[model samples]
Target: MTKKDDHKDPALVSIGSMFETGKIRKMYTLAELYPTRIAKSLGINYGRYMVKLNHPDKFTMGEIVRLADLLDIEPDMITKVIYAELN
Candidate 1:
């Protein structure tokens, strides 16, 4: 059985509206996704990107800002991840 709602275009729907309707987006971690794409965005090779991901302390402040922007996450989150090892 088809309804009027079935005819609606998903692309026309806003992300906020989807959230308001109880449809939440799944959040993924860096490790959960392939590193190649992120590496390409950062202009680094996969191997070196993986090294930075593992040892975040090696990242400079500029890199951290760039990473946060690239990942669409807050810089504090990256900061926490980098400093989490100390505590």
Candidate 2:
């Protein structure tokens, strides 16, 4: 996906919603618990996109997978968590 196409993905809003409502804080906690794997799991873009929030964290559904792996949960659970918070 090109840089321009990123803005078009609904997953962008999903990730943004997770962050905005503080749900991503749990993902952060899981990352913290497994600090050693942080580098491989989060990588450079995690920081880059976090502030700008356009890092394509949802690109290829990677963020959801990452959160699921890190939290010892499922990707669907991540979506459910973020969605639940919205309501």
Candidate 3:
């Protein structure tokens, strides 16, 4: 999504909640899950990752895919992360 739509997306808000809770995994910090090389390549450097973590709509699906791979988490989990908190 574009910067204009970043905070307007509800799904992004939910994902942000997941990130904050560390419910995505033990390593919620993107830096901890992947090194500088991968994070940078994925366009999710430390600073950007923090921004996306706080505002998930700022993340592209490609970036999420990259992070999932880095964390060894199923890509589907990224979309459904909020369910874990709901249930």
Top-lDDT structure, candidate number: 1
Q: Per-candidate TM vs. native?
A: 0.58, 0.37, 0.47
Clashing pairs in 3: none
Which candidate, 1 or 2, has the higher TM-score? 1
Q: Candidate 3's residue-wise lDDT over 11-81, tens digit each?
A: 33444456545556423343344346555756646677665655555667787676555444455666555
Q: Which parts of model 2 are misplaced by more than 4 Å?
A: 1-40, 49-60
Q: Which stretches of candidate 1 lie over 4 Å from their true place?
A: 1-29
Q: Global lDDT of each model?
A: 0.53, 0.45, 0.51
- When 2 and 3 are scored with lDDT, the better candidate is 3
| Residues 1-87 of candidate 1: C-alpha lDDT, one tens digit per residue | 112244433332332233234342221235335467666766788888777766667777877666555544455655765675435
Relative to the true structure, candidate 3 has a C-alpha RMSD (angstroms) of 12.0
lDDT of 2 at 12: 41
Model 3: ten consecutive residues of lowest lDDT = 1-10
